[model samples]
Target: MTERIAREPGRSTFIQRTRRAQLIACAIDVLAEDGYVQASLSRIAKRAGVSRGVILYHFSGRDDLLDAVVSEVYRIATEELRPTIETQSTALRAVRTFIVGSAEFYRAYPAHMAALREIVAHSRSADGTIRHSEHSRANERELSALGVLFERGKEAGEFRAFSTPIMARTIRSTLDGLLGQMRVDPGYDPVPEAHEVADIFERAMMRQSE
Candidate 1:
C-alpha cells in the first residue's frame, strides 16, 4: 500500500488518500509506542510495513506528519464527544456530559489520546522551541466553548458567581491531568474520576442560598 502512494498521478485519488490514511494510522501507533522524536519516518514506515519512501511521499517531514496526526486525533475526539454534549438539555448537564464523554472517549480510543500526548510533549521547531501552539489552541477552544456554556448557565441562573476563565481552566486542567495520569498508571480508572470531577464542578457552579 505504501508503494501504491508513490504511484504516478494517473493513479486514482482515492488510492492515494487510502495510502496516506494507512501511513497516518501507522504513524499514530509509532508515536504512541515511541516518544515523538523517536517516531521518525523510517520508524513509522516500518510500523506500517511499508518502505520509507511511502511515508515521505505522503508527508513532507516530521512536522508535517505530526500535524496530520494531531489533526486526525482532534477530529476524531471532537466528533465522538460533540454528540454527547448535544444530548444534554442544559449547560450544567453539558458540562457533565462533556467530562464523562471525554473519559469514555479516552477509554475507547486510548491510542488517540496517547499519540496526542506524545505529539504535545515532543513537537518542536527548527529553532528548538515547542511547535504545539497550533494544536494547543484547538484543545483550548474546547475549554472556551465550555466557558461560553458556563456563562449561559450563569445567565439562566443555573450557575453561581465565578469567573468563567478560571472555572474553565480548572476544569480543563483537571481533565487533562486525568488523561496524563491514566497514560502512566494502568490501575487508574476514568469512570469514577469522571463522576468525581463532575460533582466538584457541579457544586462549584451551583448558586448559593439567597
Candidate 2:
C-alpha cells in the first residue's frame, strides 16, 4: 500500500498532490450525499470522473482515503480561521473571532463538515474500533488551542477563574451541536447561533467589574 507522500519525506509531485486532493474531494462529496457505507472507492472515482485505478494510485484504500478526507477538512478549516484569529488584538477577541470564524467555515463548507460527521460516526479500523475516537489527535489539538485562549484571557484579567478543560469542552460541544442542528434542518442558520453562543461564553468567562 502506497501511502500519500504529502505527509512524509520526499513529498509528492504537483500532479500527485493534485490527484490526491481530487480524490479526497470526491470522497467528501460521496460521504456527504450517500453516507459512509456507500462511499466506496468506485463511487468516489465515479464522482471524480476517474477510474477506480486512479484513486488507488493516490490512496491505499477506502480507509486511507477517508483519513485523508478528515485531514484535508481540518487543513481547510485551520487555513480559514488561523490568520483571522491571530490578528485579534486580545485573547478575548480571538475567542470571539474563533467562534464566528467557525460558523463562516461551516456555512462555506457544509459538505466537508457533513462528510466528517459521517466518517467520525461510522468509520472503523481493522480491530473494529472507531477511527475518530473522542481522544483523537485532532480533537486534542482543538481543545488545547481553546485552553490556550482561555489561559491568555485569564492572565490578562479579561476572563474569570474557571476550569479551562470544562469550559473548552463546553464551547466545542456547543459549536458542534450547531452543525448537528444544521444536519437535521438544512435551513438552520448557524451564524446567528454562533453569535449567541459566543455571547454566552463571553459573559460566562468575562471578569465582571467591581
Candidate 3:
C-alpha cells in the first residue's frame, strides 16, 4: 500500500514580510472602525484585497496579527515621541515634551488610541504563552530612549532619584490615563489638555518648586 504525504506550503521570507505588513495595515483599519475584538482575519484580508488563506499563511491566528498591529503602532508612536526625548536639553523638559508629544500623537492617530484600549482590556483574559519576541525587542529600545531622558532629569536634579523602570512605567501610565480619558470624552481637546497636564506634571515632579 502506498501512502500520500501532504506537501508543505512554500513562501519566501520577503513575501511573508510583505503579506504581514499588508495584514497589519488592514488590522489598523478594522481596529479603527470596530476595535480589536471585532478585527478578524477574514475582514482584514478582504480590506487588504487578499485572500483569507494569505492572512493565515502569514499569521498563525488573530492574536499574532493583533500583536503585530500593536507593535507597529508602538513603532509609529515611538518615532513621533523620539524627538521630544532625544532633542530636549534637560530631563524635566524632556518629560514635559514627551507627554505633550504623546497626546498630539494620540490626537493625530485615534486608531492607535483605540487599539491600545483594546489591548489593555483584553490582555488580562488572553493567553500569556503567545511569544511576542519582536514586540518585546522593540519595546526595549523605546524604553531605553525614555530611560536616557529620565537619567538626564536625575543628573540635573530636576527629578527624584529612582529606578528607571519604575519611573518609566509611571510616566507611561500617566500618559495612558490621559489618553484614555480623551478617547472617551468627545468634547476633550488633546492639545490644550496636554499642555495643562504637562505643566501640572512637571511642577509636581520637578525638584525645584516654582
Query: Residue 121, candidate 1: how far off, in angstroms?
Result: 1.3
Q: Could you give candidate 2's per-residue lDDT for residues 63-86 as a string of tens digits?
A: 878888888888899999999999
Steric overlap count per candidate: 0, 0, 0
Better of 2 and 3 by lDDT: 2
Q: How close is every model to the real structure, measured as TM-score?
A: 0.87, 0.91, 0.78
Tens-digit lDDT track of model 3 for 11-115: 345555666677788788887788766777788888999898777666667777777777788878887887557787777888788888888888888876777
Worst 10 residues of 1 by lDDT: 3-12
Per-residue CA lDDT of model 1 for 35-55, tens digit only, reads 787988889888989898767
Segments in model 3 whose C-alpha atoms lie over 4 Å from true places: 1-16, 126-144, 162-166
> On a 0 to 100 scale, what is the lDDT of residue 166 in model 2?
99
Q: Model 1 lDDT vs. the true structure?
A: 0.82
RMSD of model 3, in Å?
5.6
Candidate 2 wrong stretches, greater than 4 Å: 1-10, 123-128, 133-135
Clashes of 3: 0
**What TM-score does candidate 2 reach?**
0.91
- Candidate 2 has an lDDT of 0.86
Ranked by TM-score, top first: 2, 1, 3
